[model samples]
Target: MAVEILIVDDDPLIRQTLHQQLVALGYSPHVAEDRRSAEQQLARQEFALVILDLALPDTSGLALLKHWQEAGTSLPTIMISGTATIPDAVEALKLGAADFLVKPVDMFLLEATLKRVLAAQALRSENTRLKQLTRGGRVDFLGDSPCIRELLAQAERVAATEQTVLVEGETGTGKQVLARWIHARSGRADEPLLAVNCAAITETLFESELFGHEKGAFTGAGERKPGKLELVGRGTLFLDEVGELPLLCQAKLLTAVEDRVFERVGGTRQMRFEGRIIAATNRILSQEIGKGGFRRDLYYRLSAFAMRLPALREHADDIPLYIGQALERCRRQYGRTFEPPDDNTLRQLKANSWPGNVRELYHHVERIALLTDGPRIPRSLWLSFPTEPESEPTDIPTGDLRTAMTGFKRKYIQRVLARCGGNQTEAARQLGIERTHLNHLLAEYDGRR
Candidate 1:
């Protein structure tokens, strides 16, 4: 997200001009008519900067700035006024305003001042770094679908323990989010949560990345560095796509996890890890184990507790909630507000297949919100699935039963997926097979293709 600024002023012209100016400069600018609206915006969202006018309908802007300072709120603020004396500027500065500008604020001056203030804030504290990662604050699952509610219930119970968890689902199903959900409710909520992408790291670097490597440990090792397990302290270590980890690294990881102790690469000293482990994967490890790609024992250890995040199509009833959440985020991050979808519009949203899950749905909502200029979204601006042609049954081929059945199954699955708008889960449900089994069959078909 870009830098989001809140412009608080009572003058309609000043608000409109500033909003346009900020947008022209590639900044996200939200507007508030008075102190009351300003407070509401601040409470609901985190802003990078505030451009406040001296006069507000309900209260003087100086008082609000002073209140923020005294309340220990950390926000870089600029105070602007048309009828201000030099004394007002000094008072505004004393009230902890980043800069004071006389109204008819110069565009160059405002831009330069904003840049200077933000640059200084970045170097001032570690909190600035944390703000980007957790600007949303505590995350709450927005959907009330049965699958979501059930997942929340299970997460609440699992979060009470220190068990190793393995989260499984399709891509963009919010596996890492579920990890955060658990860690936030766990005993280690105060500690940091760190993640490692098992699929991204090379086989040679995997061990050293999981466990700290000593100085001169390998060819590129110039100095000792701590790994995620060490840096996480008593927090949670999230291993994303854990099933893709190299077999050699998995064996080393199993021992370290089982014993709760690890040796730094090329070092004799043993280090014990006290942090909890949470692994997530889009792949089904049981299927991977059968294919000799993932370790069975490691899978067992990680699966001490396992859960799957439901695909968006499975929880289609929650489409409205997800769309609303996306629009709310757009309002916060892009200063864009969208009207609620009408009953028929929402029904279309619920019925459409979301093949890419929640992430994809969020992006689609954002796109529509950005494009819609009217107060209400256009009913015609809805997603449409590509319809598959009706597949007719064919006479039995002269091939053997095994070959005939294989070809039939492949074509049948493909047709079903097409009918479901490329939704694998729905296709699997229709075929009365596990989603993982369907995935394997698809993988086989793709390999042959």
Candidate 2:
């Protein structure tokens, strides 16, 4: 499609000249004579580029730009002036104007500026799309639920700012994923992202880990080593399981994160770092504060932009999609063909109240695939707490453990076929077996649910 250009100028000659130049370049051009006409055109049409004159008889172009910004109009506008001033150009740029062009505008220069601005907009759009699609490029996010969708949108908005995000979630709910997503979309994405698992570090090593240690500072210290704070300069530092931080370390960390400066362990020399701090916890921070487990002041600072990830049980509907993706990942890791759970197995998987959430479900699938024989994994591979009674054993003479195993497998095959809505392909995938082996199993068992 041809690019759409809007020319907003009071002078008919200037407008006509710009229109001709745009048309020569194969652009669809629209002309507006006055402020009212321009406003009307903007309301009715969508333009990729707007050539806006600074001085209008009825209203100033700068004023129009400000109005457009206030009204949430995102069209890229290039400001044109017959008498351009440094202040005017600065002000135009501050008001979200794309470019400032001095009058007697050269056609080539104008086209070049327009192309550059359009390319920038296109890049931004593409980045947004990729961020939205790739699990929001989240560190550990593993679900495709509506709750996660809304959380990603929130993350996008928060990332544009330098707010200290505090992610709160239950244990194993992937708080680190939310923190990484926030850092990934932030302005400091190019900078390093350093993480400190507070729960993993002891109180004795907390200070050294957070603040660099000078030579001979501790028993094992040989050379100077930078801490997480110093190492993450002009980037982001993630503190996971912050509730485990000791009081003294908490105070020091709070000061460093707030002031953007810190002193190394056993050293008095100060160091500065321009970066963002994102903290996460599995416990209720407010309750922790009341219980004297966390610092109130620090909590307020970290909670500037709070986000929570939904538990897997809350978004069980997304399990099938997650299973499919997880299975693909497993297949890649194990060098096996992808086989999704059959409908019956999927139903059973979804019905379970996943107390361990996504992490647990992943391990379960990986383990079951390893234990099951052939390509198809029958429902028997998974531990099912069925309420139905166990059938009495048939006493057949000359029966061995291998025969008993075959008979058990036959019954399990029948049960799975009964649950898979009669789709052989789905049944095979669910059993984690090859389609051919699944067909043989089904033939041996027949359709006896």
Candidate 3:
């Protein structure tokens, strides 16, 4: 189908010129003389792009842009003005205009800008679709364990409503995946679902990142930016590791959650937040609140429907099913068939505690698939289970048990560190150890080396 373009301009000559150019370029062009007519056209038909003139008879074009933006309209727009200024251009872009142009617009340049804006919008739409497909394409909860069944039941019940949810689980326990499952099953599944990790964001930039900032709001604030809250209009915003949000941000976020209204930093205009919030945290928020690190009020507001994800150890019986799913994903990801783990290898995997939960299992399976020479993974390639300090290696002298254990610990830590690209925090999380403890071990190994 030919792309549809909406031209909103007061001057008949400019509108006619744009219409002719668009038609010549094989686009379906619609003209509106004022904001009222443009709005009526918008309501009546869907346009791929809107060419707006800043000076309209009924209202300023910027006012119309703001109206559309606040209404969560995703239509790509290009703003034009005869008496254009830098501030006007900045404001237009801030209001979500795709591009800005001055009047006496060259026909060629106008067509080029329209094409670029529409193409960019198409790319964004495609990217969003791909993300949704990737997230929603995973297998079902692959366990018949009672805990898993109960969790699925609860998720179904929660998916029927728009209530805020707080998902609590240890790291690598598939909390975000569960959130995605709930979102996909919900009525708002057709809308966008964005995830942000609070723990990953720096405290200094948290406010601007979440609530956005106006141009000139700070030294580096070159353009007005919309935050995640604004972009998640009528969708779902998954805040991972919500406990890590700074106290100052927690207060503001609580207000937004309760009142559904917030203003961009350094801007006085209030914006509405029309999204459901699903927050997750590995830490016990109640403990964090008691320690004065998190707010109790915010905790209460977010935990209206709390869901706790069971650790992998809690459902050991489901390991076989999980392994099967992991192997399937690995096969598709690597474009190679992999035979499942042998009986001994499976026993070894099930015997060890999976501190990193399903994530660890998935990575382990991928590693085995990649490293094994043949289709089936053998027990010899498996990582050795950690032994007690006094346990002796078969080939080691009795007095050298501690030395052998130290060597084993160092090698294990190094392997995990390498897997995490030397990120100590991530390595520590995967190893189920404290970051400080990981640091101490690294220091000891370095000193010994």
Candidate 4:
């Protein structure tokens, strides 16, 4: 996800130029001409980082930063000044300014500073959340679907023990939610919940990641670093997407799981940890074992206490409940009270299959809330499904399945395309797909013509 940045400056040229630069750097930049507009944006929602000019037409940027600190908004702010002095820089730093940059700032330096500040802020938030997780509080596991409820029950039971657990489910099935729930209920509830996406780490960095590395251990090992397992201490180490872990790393992981000890890359000393292991994956482990992608022994160790989350399709009955929940959440987040769907709209909602699951539902709800003029969302929201001509037959009937299916898909696609002003890119964006994917589907339909 791109970071959201708010740039506060009175100069229109500076704001426009920086906005363009920030957008090109994969950030959503919102410009505020003065302190008032900046405060409004800050009050509305949090930004990943803020770039504040030292002088605004209405107020000094230092006062604005202090105001933010007083108002309890902890957004990291970078102070940019054309007439900066040592005392001014010290004062700004004392007021929680992340970094001070002189005006006519080197673009490279500005980008590097923003990246570092944003990364530090993210790490701080992560660490704080981890500390809170270790305080033995109950995690509010969302969703009341039967599948989720059953998973919760299983989790509650498994969390009372120290055995390694393997959670299996498709992506966006809230695997991390279940992992956090387990941590909250476990005996190690008052310890850190260190989560690592095994798939994201490369084979070469696997040892350094799973175990702490000493200074001079390897190139770029400028300082000693503690791995997730060590940072987790006596808490929980969650290995998300464990199925994608490299084959060579799997052997080392299995040994670490068995002995609770590991050596960092280029380090001879062994470090021991007693943290609980919770691994999650979207792939079927048995199938992967047959394909020689995953180790059977490691799978068995992790699956000592196993739970599988049912896909959204199997739990179609819960769609209405989830839709209602998502709408309410969107209303709270967006600060707009949208009326619940009417009877006909609710019926359409129940009929549709949410392939992207809860995550998709949330996005759709947010989009509808923002796009709809009035409070009530109509059946149009439900009519936004992609043109799946071949798949429409199952919903219709036999006899003239091909004709019926094609007619339905074409009508739906054309309606949405028209609503989006014939712009395929915008239509695809509204439908949550790439324009190329939409073109391919349209071509497929054209072939049937």
Better of 1 and 4 by lDDT: 1
Candidate RMSDs in order: 17.3, 21.8, 13.2, 18.7
Q: After superposing candidate 1, which stretches have Cα over 4 Å from the reference?
A: 1-136, 384-449
TM-score of each: 0.58, 0.54, 0.61, 0.57
Model-by-model lDDT, in order?
Answer: 0.85, 0.80, 0.86, 0.83
The digit string of per-residue lDDT tens for model 4 on 1-449 reads 77889999988888888888888777899999997898788889878889999999999988988887898878899999888899989999999999999877677898789877876676567666777855755677676777778878888898899989999988777788889888888888777888899989999988888886777998899756667776776889999999999889899899999888987666788889889999999999988998899999999989998889887776766667777787788777778777777777766766667666667766777777777765777677656765445554454534587777877877778778988989999888887889998899899888977
- For model 3, residues 344-391, the per-residue Cα lDDT tens digits are 777767777988888887777777777765566666656543344776
Q: Residue pairs in steric clash, candidate 3? A: none
lDDT of 4: 0.83
lDDT of 3: 0.86
Candidate 1 lDDT, 1-449, residue by residue in tens: 67999999999999899988898888999999999999999999999889999989999989999999989998999999999989899999999999999889889998888877876565444333433453446867667988899999999999999999999999988898889889888897777787899989998888788887877989888756667676676778899999888899899889988999988888898888988999999998998998899999999999999999999889988888887788888788767567878888788888777777888888787777777764577876655333458787675655899888988888888889988989998999999999999989999989987
Report the alpha-carbon TM-score of model 4 versus the true structure: 0.57
Model number with the top lDDT: 3
Candidate with the greatest TM-score versus the true structure: 3
What is the per-residue lDDT of model 2 for residues 1-449, given as tens digits with 9 covering 90 to 100?
A: 99888999999999999989999978999999879999898889788879999999889999999999999987899999999799999999999999999988999998789877886676455444433433334454555678988888888899899888888887767777677777777787766677789989988888888887887887999756767776666677889999888888789878987787888887989889677888888888898997798999999888998888777888888888776676777777777755666787778788887777777777777776666542566667664432447787684434798877877787677667778977888878888899999887777667545
* lDDT-sorted candidate list, best first: 3, 1, 4, 2
